[model samples]
Target chain A: MENIALLMHGFAIAFSLENMAAAIFGAVAGLIIGAMPGLGGITGVSLLLPLTFGMNPTTAIIALAGLYYSTMYGGAFSAILLNIPGDSPAIVTSLDGYKLTQKGLPGKALNASTVSSFIGGTIGIIILTISGPLLAEAGLAFGAPELALLVLFALTSIGWLLGDDIPAGLLATAIGLMFATIGVDPALGQTRFSFGQINLLSGVSFIPLVVGFFGFSQVIDMIISGEDGAVATKVRIRDCVPTGKEIKMMLPVSIREGIIGTFVGVMPGAGATTSAFLSYIIEKRINKHRDEIGTGSMIGVAAPESSNNAAAAGAFAPLLTLGIPGGATTAVLLGGLMMWGLQPGPLLFTEQPDFVWSLIASMYIGNVICLILAFICIPILVRAISVSKKVLVPIIIAVCVIASYANSNAMFDVVLMLICGILGYLMKLADVPTTPMLLTFVLAPMLEQYVRQSFDMTRGNPSIFFRGGICWFFIVLILLVSFSPLIKNFYLKMKDKKAN
Target chain B: MGYVLPGLSVLMGLYWAVKAFGYRLWVLNGPGGGLFPLIAGILAIIFGVVMIMRRYRTKKKSDFSVKSIFPVVSVIGIIIASYIIGLIPSLGVFIIAWMVFYEKEPWLKSTAVGIGTALVFYLVFDLWLAVPLPMGLFELI
Candidate 1:
C-alpha cells in the first residue's frame, strides 16, 4: 500500500512539464540515435549526457533513463530494414527481421518488433518496480565486507561473462583498476599515481573516459572501415500495424519472452544481448514454428525484441538498488548519476524516494512515448539510417569535443579524452572486452574503500571477510563465476566420457 | 600492434608497482593506498606478459591500415588547432577540410556544413547554456 502511494506521488512528479518534456525529448533522441548504425545505447547516452547538466537531478535522470530504454525500441528500425544492427542487442533481430523484410513483409516485421519491444519494456519496468525496493532492503543490511565482496563478485562475473577471451577480459579489468588508483587515495589522502599533474589529484574524470571509449572510438572505427550508409527500405505507416491474427499469435510469445528477459536482465553480467539470444534459442525450441524461426517467422522478430527490451529494464535493478551497473549502458548511467552528485544504492531509495520513483515512473511514460514516436517516425528513421559517414563523423567529433570540454570547462579533459579514445581504439582492435574494463574502473575505488574499511574494523585480519554469510556467499559466487568456464569444460568432458 | 600494446601495459605496470612499493603498504590498521595499485600492477604485469607471449605463439592478422591513420591524424590536427584558435573555428576548419579533401564533398556544401556546425555550437553552448567558450583569435566574433 505504501509502495502504491509512493509510486502515485512519483507519477505526479514525473508528470510535471519539465520532466515530461525531458522524457519525450530523450525518447525521440534515443530512437534517432539508436537507429544509427555503429551507435548503440552506451554511445548515444555518453555523447548526449552533457545536455542534462545544470538540470534538476530528477529531471536529468528521467531524461537519461528514458534514453536508456527507448534505444531498445529505436534499434529495431535499422535491424529490420537494413539488416544492420543499430546496436549489439539488435544483432539477433537483424537475422530474421531482415529475412522477413526480404520476403516483402517489412510491415509485419516492423510491427512485430515495435509491439514486442513495448510489451517487453513495459513488463520489465513492472518487474523493476516490485523487485527494486526488495533488493535495496537486502542491500541495506550489507556491511563493508559485504560491499567489497559484492563489488568483487560484479567485477569477476562481468569479466567471465562479457567476453569470449577470459584472459583479455581480466587484463582489461586490471588496467581499469590500475587507472582507478591514479588519484589521491580515498582512504589515506596520499597521491599515488598522478605523475606530478595537478589535475590528477581528483582522478580521471568518468565523462572523458566514457566519451572516448564509446563515442570517439566509433568515429575511428568508421573512418578506418570507411563504412557508409545502410540499405534503404520503404514501409507505409498504415501497413506497419500487425493484423489481428498476427497480434493474437504474438501476444503470449512476447510476454513470455519479456518475462524471461526481465529475469535474465536482473542477473548481474547477463546483459540484453545475452537475453535476446537466449530468448531466441528458447523460442526456437518451444514454439510450434521452431523450424521456421530464422526463415521470416514472426516469432523470430517478436521474441528477441521483447526480450532485449526486458533485459534492458531488468538491468536497472542492480544499478539502482546495488549501485552496480547491469551492463555497459547502465554503467554510463551510473556515471551520469555520480556526475549529478547522486549515488544509486539503498540510500537512494530511502534518502531520495521521490527521485527514484519518479525515474521509474518516467520509464513507464517514456517507453509508451517511444513506441508512438518510433511508429510514427519509421519513414524518417529509415531514411536517417542512410546518413553518410562523411557527414556523421565530423559531427560526432565536434560533439565529443563539446561534451568533453563543456562539463568542466577544461581543455585538459579534451586531451584526456583523446588519449582514452586512442586506448579504446587499440583495445577494440585487440578484441578485448571493454565492458568489464569500464565496470571495473567504476567499481574499483568503491571496492578498495570497502576492503580497507573492513580490514580496519577487523584489525587487519582477513578472516573478517569469511564471518558474514553474505560476504561468504559473494566470495563463493565470485569463485564459481571466475572458474565456471573451466568447470563447464570439465563437465562436458565428463559427460562425453559417460556417453562413450 | 598486439604485442606492443600489451608490452606497453607490462612496462607501465612494473613502473607503477615499483613506485608504489616505496609507499607504506599498510597503515591505519588497514590496506593503504599503495596496496590496491600494487595488486593491480602485479595483475597487469602477469596478464600483459601472457598476452604478449600468446601473440608470439599465434600469428594474428593485423587489421591496422594506413588509410585509417589519416582520420586519426586529422583529429589530432583539429585538437591542436582548437587549442590555438578556439573550438568553434577549429571545428569549422576541420569540417571543411575533412569534407572537401577526404570525403570529396563540394567546397560549397562543405563550407555550409562547417559554418552551420559552428553556429549551432555557438548558439547552444555560448548563447543558451551560457557556457564561456574560449574564442581565442575568434574572440572578436
Candidate 2:
C-alpha cells in the first residue's frame, strides 16, 4: 500500500509538461544514435550530457535515462535492417533480423524488436521499483569490510572475465584508481598526484575521459574502419506496425524473453553479451518451432532484444541498491548521478525517498514517450541512410568538437580529447577491448578509497579481509577467473584432438 | 605500427611510474599515494609487452592501411588552424569550406551552406541558449 502512494508521487513527477517533453526528445534521439552501428545508449547519453548542464538535474536525468530504453528499441531496427548492431545487446537481432529482412519480414522483425524491448524494459522497471529499496536495506547492513571486498571482487571478476589476460584489465583499473586519486585528497589536504599542474589538482574530469574514450575515439575509429554509411540503412519491413496475426504469434516468446532478461539483467557480471547468447540458446532449446530459430524467425529477434533491454534496466539494480555500477553505461550514469548531486546507495532511500521514487516513476512515462516518437520517426530516420558517409563524417566531427568544447569551454579538454582519441584509436588497432577501460574508469576511485579506508581501519592487519566470508567469496571468484585461461586452453585442445 | 605503438605505450607507462614514485609511497596510516598508479603503470607496460609479443607470435593480419593517415591528418590540421584563427565562427567557416573543397562541391554552394550553418548554430547555441562563444573578429555581437 505504501508502494502505491510512492508510485503515485512518482507519476506526478514524471507526468510534468517539461519532463514529458524531455523524455520524448530523449526517446527520439536515443533511437537515432542507437541505430548507428558502434554507437548505443551509452554514446547517446554521453553525447547529450553536455546539454544537461543547464537543466534541472531531475529533468536532465529523466531524459538521459529514457535514452537507455529507447536506444534498445532503436538498435533493433538497425540490426534487422542493416545486419549491424549498435551495441553488444543488439547483436542477436542481426542474425535472424537480417535474415528476416531478406525474406521480406523486416517489418515483423522490427516490430517484434520494439514490442519486446518495451515489454522487457517495463518489467525491468517494475522489478527496480519494488526491489530497489529492499536490496538497499540489506546493503546498508554491510560494513566497511563488506564494501572493500565488493569492490575488489568486482575488479577481480571483471579482470578475469575479459579473458585469461588478467594483467591488462587490472593494469587499466589500477590506472583508473590512480587517476581517481589525482585531486586534493579528501583525507588529507595535500595534492598527491598533481605534480604541480593546476588542472591535475582538480583531478581529471569525467566528462573529457568519457567523451574522448567513447565519442572522439569512436569518430576516429569510424574514419579508420571506412565509415560505410552502415547506420543509414532504413527498416522497410512492409508493415511498419505489426499485424494482429503476427502479434499473436510473437507475444508469448517476447514476454518470456522479457521475464528471463529482467532476471539476467539484475545479476552482477551478467552483461548483455552473455544475456543475448543465453536468450538465443534458450529460444532454440525451448521454442515450439526450434528449427525456425535462425532462419528469419520473429522469435529470434524478440528473445535477445527483450533480454538485452531487460538486462540494461536490470543493470540498474546493483548500482541503485549498493552504489555499484553493473556495466559501462551504468558507470557513466553514475557520473550523471553525481552531477545531479544525488548519490546512489543505501541511504538514498532513507534520505531522499522522493527523489528515488520520482526517478523510478519517470521511467514509466519515459518508456511510453520513447515508443510513440520511435514509431513516428522510423521512415525519416531510415531515409537518412541514403546520406553518404563521406559527407556525414565531417559534419559529425564538427558537432563533436563543438559539443566537447561547449561542455566547459576549456581548450585543455579539447586537447585532452585529441590525445585520448589517438590512444583510443591505437588501442582499437591493438585489439584490446575498450569495454574494460570503461569499467576501469567506473571502478578506479571506489577501489582506491575502499582499499585505503579498509586498510586504515584494520591497522595494517590483512585479517580484516577474512573477518567476513564476503571477501573470501570474491577472492575465490577472482581465482577462478584467473585460472580460466588454462581451463579454456585445455578445452580447446580436447576439441582439436577429437576433430583430428 | 606494431612495435611503435606498443613501444609508445610502454614509454608512457614508464613515465607515469616515475611520476608515481615522486609521490611518497603510503602516507602515514594511509595507502601510499603511488599505490594505485605505480601498479597501473607497471601493468600497462607488461600488457604492452604481451601485445607486442602476440602480434609477432600469431603473425596476425593488419586491418589498418596507410591511406588512413589522410583523414586523420586533415581533420587534425583543421582543428589546429581553428585554434590559430582564435575565432569560433571562423573555425565554423573553415569547417564548411574544407568540406566543400575536400568533397569538390562548388565554391558558391559551399560558402552559402557554410554561412547558413554558421548562422543557425550561432543562433541556436549562442543567441538563444546564450552560451558564451568566442567572438573573434566579430566581437561586436
Candidate that would win on TM-score? 1
Q: Write the per-residue lDDT of candidate 2 for residues A232-265, one digit (tens) a residue.
A: 4455535557778767867887778777776656
Q: How far does residue B60 in candidate 1 sit from its true spot (Å)?
A: 3.9
Task: Please list the residue runs of candidate 1 whose C-alpha ends up more than 4 Å from where it truly belongs after superposition.
Answer: A1-136, A161-164, A229-367, A370-382, A428-431, B59-61
Candidate 2 clashes between residue pairs 3 or more apart in a chain or in different chains: A107-A237, A232-A385, B26-B32
- Candidate 2, residue A138: Cα displacement in angstroms equals 2.4
TM-score of each: 0.69, 0.67
Mind giving the per-residue lDDT tens digits that candidate 2 earns over B4-111? 556676776787688776665677666666667677678768877777787889887656766456545654665665555543555466656666766677777667
Superposed model 2: Cα runs more than 4 Å off:
A5-121, A128-132, A142-148, A157-196, A213-362, A467-472, A488-500, B54-91, B107-120, B127-130
> lDDT scores for all predictions?
0.78, 0.66
Model 2 chain A worst lDDT run, 10 consecutive residues: A135-144
- DockQ, prediction 2: 0.37
